[model samples]
Target: MGTSAERTGLPDTEGISALPADVPAWRVLLSYVRPHRGALLAGGVLSLATAASGLVLPLVVRELIDNLGSDGPVAELVAAMAALVLINAAIGALGSYVLHRTAESVVLEARHHLIGRLLRLRLSAVERHEPGDLMSRVTADTTLLRVVTTDSLVGGVTSVLALAATVVMMGLMDLTLLGVTLLALAVAVVVIGLVVPRIHRAARHAQESVGVMGAALERMFGAFRTVKASGAEDREGDRLRGAASEAWRASVRAGKWEAVAGNTGGLAVQAAFIAVLSVGGARVASSAIEVGTLVAFLLYVYYLMPPVNQLASAVTQYQVGAAAVARIQEAEALPIEQLGPLPRATDQPIPSPPPRLQPTGTTSAPAAVTFDRVSFRYDPELPVVHDEISFAIPPGGMTAFVGPSGAGKTTVFSLIERFYEPDTGHVLLDGIDVQAWSLTDLRAAIGYVEQDAPVLSGTLRENLVFGAPGATAEEVERALRTTRLSAMINALPDGLDTTVGHRGMKLSGGERQRVAIARALLRRPRLLLLDEATSQLDAVNEAALRDTIAEAARTTTVLVVAHRLSTVTLAHRIILMDAGQVRAIGTHRELVTNSPLYAELAATQFLATAG
Candidate 1:
């Protein structure tokens, strides 16, 4: 099987922790806008109309001023000016509402895409990245896109158009005043351009630092009980504080640059307003322009300030948004599993499929598993875990694997499940390459209980039905009875519906193990792989579950990885492994007499007696 990185054509993330800058930030920013273009366009049109009304208001006021002493109706002129003011106010409010609403939609779409991508990411890729850092990208980073799509994208266009129109209106009144305003604004542009790139770098660092803080906090919570037992609360708190302080430093730096850009625009606009006023007053005194024209041009100069300031703000927002987009793009670039047929993302709500009816009985024909000279290692730098090892298990039998720590025992289970592909050679199921089988179907045929027997946070029923959502009531009862969990469930406050705390913490270790086994059993798989599945069970429960396993072997292939001799003594065959190779294959009695390692392990660890 091809490695996930090779198959997906994504660079192995093991060595590349930094965000790649290969894609242009602008292109990433535009991609987000493409999906919401219709809404953005509508908001932009409204914004433009608002600007148009503002532009016309000055002209209306100018008309009122010029006709003050004329025979024309003064009351009518006042009414026209009043109407323009109300129109401008109403349109501006509506436009703002539209833009803000669209901004929220952009955020929603980004989060949906990002969450979907993260969930489907390859296991290797996920293991390489921190969970909290990925979470920061989903929450904080996606939030930044809202402002970028609205203010930086659509609002930026509106500001530019309005600025252009205001300049034209000023020109019609007086070219001299327009030139003065433009010259003053030019210096601010030069200053702003010099610092804009710095904002992007600063903002990127700030976001990265926040992720670091989140990672630190998550680490503490994951081992909360251990930290308390070890009395390392103060030490861990200091570490979290250090991460937060670093984030604070980076955020302050970003804010400083943004303030500089925004303030520079305000300063430039104010200077331009003063220059326009001084020039227009001189023109009015010289009679080169009428008092009404001078007043109107001054109003136009005042109007120009907002758009100019807005343009500056938009640029600064883009820099911050681009930093976030770069981080988001890096996460999206990680390799993802190509699990069998799934739905493409869409805006429409997906209707849930009707519950699938599962057969009440276990599979009639058990599956045969084979490993063909397979070699594997988790990483290139690590020592090989399996060195050209080969093994086979026929259908419908109980087999046990016994090995010392680091002897590649659990790796066998992983290989069978294709969690990590073999570095060389093949793993086959019933003579067909496992890689060739559909992942969904291949997994459906195998029931795996991991070494930890992890249980998710949910109700007792949810955990039991996780692997088989459609298991019939009778099947559920049978599994519970087989696992000796009937008494525990009957005693619960809500029976099967009782809530199990996080990681099933509310249940005892042994009960959690039973829940995990029962969950797998509900699937009625042909090949059942149990890795230390009964390690936590007491003697009575262990013997009962062992009998259940012996019975299950009659109908399915049962493979167990165990250290206890009692667990494997009755197996039809046992494979003893040492260092990455199979040392001996025989019944427990045959191995006890023939293999020195097996005899030593049985006598020392398993407390076996040679009767």
Candidate 2:
């Protein structure tokens, strides 16, 4: 019952979630940790206990020094020390196993969340992002959560606790020496704090640059055909090289920051060592501290450095991980359209609605789509594609839209398909306002084919039945025969099983279009919208397409965007569009006599020449 935001990666918040990016590093890390509370607690306790084992070495040393020559108890002491070491080693390993297991789970959950979010994103939102960049963020950025949660996050806490215990032990052994060491180490702590943020910033920049490189390469390769045709291989390669170089530079910058952070801890530890030696030497000479106690105190002092250093290193790692979190969080913040208005992650997800069935009663009749004073545009600043224009295509016959390019012929189809909402006026489908019909039901009744009629890289049968997953084999054959794909299928080595290649490049333009038509026909839709369905067809194929349209029209409505007017000259009716308005509507002769625009379109460049 997870809401769309939960099912997807979106957080339960309004607007682009700048919060995960802007929140304190600890808070953000804690959010990921919260899901594995029991494991974190158990792992933390084990890690702390293991860290305590280091203190035992100092005690064992002190005991050996104190018991020397008194009892030749070396064997017993050695055995005891060895036992402690084994236990510590075993505990630390188990803690590591638990933490890393939790880390892997976090990474998996994050990837699933991001993939869901990407899929649920509105069509327009997805168009804004490069597929490669989004892909990198999902695959690469989410992995960072693993290290952040385990090594840097839990490990850092354990290091701090161990460091605290060591400092206390050192202070008990000798207060003055401990104070001197802390003073010197204070400088290192300050340095680490200053440089750690730089590491984070550098890591962010590096990741961003990598994403940019991926996006650039994806864009170039997506249109590789055009690039190869234009012979821009060298230029495109240089462009990709520049992007890669930028990524390299950014990574180098992050490396520089990491080096500085690591060195700060080393320098602090070195200076503290020197200060403690000087102070402790004076105290031993004055007989203020015993030799064994001094040795034990120094041992604790040395023990303090690793955890101190680990804490610093963890902070630096946090910066690196934080940068990745920012990218992931940003994607989660994008507006999700399918969550309904004011979409937010919630406890209950909106389930897919049940299919809508056409009403069947003596009083109810099939719907004829109507546009009443519709006005629409893709961009608000741009001119309207459909300008307060209206038309009606009654059901039960083939209807053809004929017009020049950009005359809003396609816009009409777009509105009917609900790809874009009209700025004003109503688009009615079947006696009811289109806005009232649920999206699922509205789309369920119609079959649409674009001008290019794209086919995915798969078996021809897959492309054929894509719209109608439940269509039987006989239904598929019937569609192939009607759209003239049966002949091409016979030539293919595997017939309907042949690979179509990317965008169906393996098939000819005409065959691809026929495959698309066949796919639409298999859907058995109440309304079929085909844009330029026969534009790529030869005379024989075009005649076959026209006959198929006429036959399909007997049972359901067929709407086609006619490119060659002569092909649809015998259609039941024609809606002639000019400059986003319905200039005239009639049959071939009626339009030729009544509308000059229609006559010119039928007798001129596109139609007459093609015919």
Candidate 1 collision pairs = none
Cα TM-score per model: 0.90, 0.86
Off by over 4 Å in 1: 1-21, 69-72, 340-360, 608-611
Clashes of 1: 0
Summarize candidate 1's per-residue lDDT along 439-557 as a digit string, tens digits. 67778888899888988988989999999998879889999999999999999889999998877878888999999999998888888999988788888999999999999899888
lDDT of 2 by residue, 406-492 (tens): 999887877887666778888877756655566666777788889989998899989998988877777788888898777777887
After superposing all C-alphas onto the true structure, candidate 2 shows an RMSD in angstroms of 5.0
Residue-level lDDT for 252 in candidate 2: 97
Give the Å shift of residue 453 in candidate 2. 2.2
Worst 10 residues of 1 by lDDT: 345-354
